[model samples]
Target: MFAEIKNIKSEKSDLRKFGITIGVILLVIAGFLFWKEKESFQIILAIGITLFIAGIVKPNILKP
Candidate 1:
């Protein structure tokens, strides 16, 4: 029981880490896009692609 509880906690931690990493990456991308004068649609597209790649690389991190 304790092991299961530990596993659950660790999974939540991993998810948090993944979220933070993605958030930072997106912020940087947004900054760069703004600097380059890109359209809002382009920024949204970049975010979608980033998330798609992240999901492929870490499917487990996104599990519910």
Candidate 2:
């Protein structure tokens, strides 16, 4: 009952490496599209870069 529900909520799924990689690439490309009119996308690119870097570092950190 409660224990079963707790176990389900406690599980943390691993990040999807392949999908993240593709998204990071797309973000980088979109970041370059600077028309001075489309400004919100730059932040998205920055976040993507940050996520990519974190993804790389996370694996290394966990490895023995």
Candidate 3:
């Protein structure tokens, strides 16, 4: 369920915004996990950061 590039216009669309929100939440969780010295934190941190950046730079990458 993705909209075409031509339909996105100049601003971030709803999907992009939602993705960004989830990414931020994941990042926060990852930070907390890191503070607690959890090993899985690295994986979560990576995914979180990637999603966060992608959500802003290329949101369509997450589609499909």
Candidate 4:
């Protein structure tokens, strides 16, 4: 009963979704900067890694 009220207090507390999105966005921006630096190898590596992790991560954006 009380759990419902507590859940509404903070959406970020969702276990199914962590701070992965924020990290991904930041990684993308950083990757872009690195790419402009002529670091194509690392750009591919970072993008591949970010996509791989994002694909497996289950983000909870709703109250189930």
Candidate 5:
């Protein structure tokens, strides 16, 4: 049981890292889109913001 709990903690830590990485990537893409002045910039920005928020709220949501 102790080992299982340890494994779960590690998994959650990994998921948090993964979530942050994904969020950063999305934000970067949004930044690029804004720099390029693309019509889809707002859409991507919104998605990026949502993902970033989701990453914070529940890192495991993006896990799979």
Candidate 6:
């Protein structure tokens, strides 16, 4: 029972970390787009690519 509880807690923690990482990435991208006066579609495409790459690289990011 305790092991299951610990696993649940760790999963939540990992999700929260991933959320934070993605949020920061988006914010930086938004700032750059604003600075450059770029199109909104470009921002969306950039974010999509960023997320795809992040998914591929997630294990390294999540490692302690």
In TM-score terms, candidate 3 sits at: 0.73
Q: Each prediction's Cα RMSD? A: 8.5, 6.7, 4.8, 8.0, 6.0, 8.6
The candidate scoring highest on TM-score is 3
Clashing pairs in 3: none
Give all TM-scores, in the order shown.
0.49, 0.44, 0.73, 0.35, 0.65, 0.47
Error of 6 at 5 (Å): 21
lDDT for each candidate structure: 0.62, 0.55, 0.79, 0.53, 0.73, 0.58
C-alpha positional error of residue 48 in candidate 5 after TM-score superposition, expressed in Å: 2.2
- Please report the candidate that would top lDDT against the real structure: 3
CA deviation > 4 Å runs, candidate 3: 1-12
Tens digits of lDDT, candidate 6, 1-25: 8667656533545655664567567
Runs in model 6 deviating more than 4 A are 1-10, 41-64
Candidate 1, residues 1-64: lDDT per residue as tens digits?
8667656643645765665567567767777777888877466557755655555466455644
Error of 1 at 13 (Å): 0.4
Between the candidate structures 3 and 5, which one is better when assessed by TM-score?
3
Better of 1 and 3 by lDDT: 3
**Model 2 per-residue lDDT at 45:** 73
Q: Which 10 successive residues of model 2 have the least lDDT summed?
A: 7-16
Error of 6 at 14 (Å): 0.2
- Candidate 4, residues 7-54, lDDT tens digits: the string is 563353443233454446657776776767856646655764554454
Please give the lDDT score for candidate 2.
0.55
The clash count of every prediction, one per candidate, is 0, 0, 0, 0, 0, 0
Better of 1 and 2 by TM-score: 1
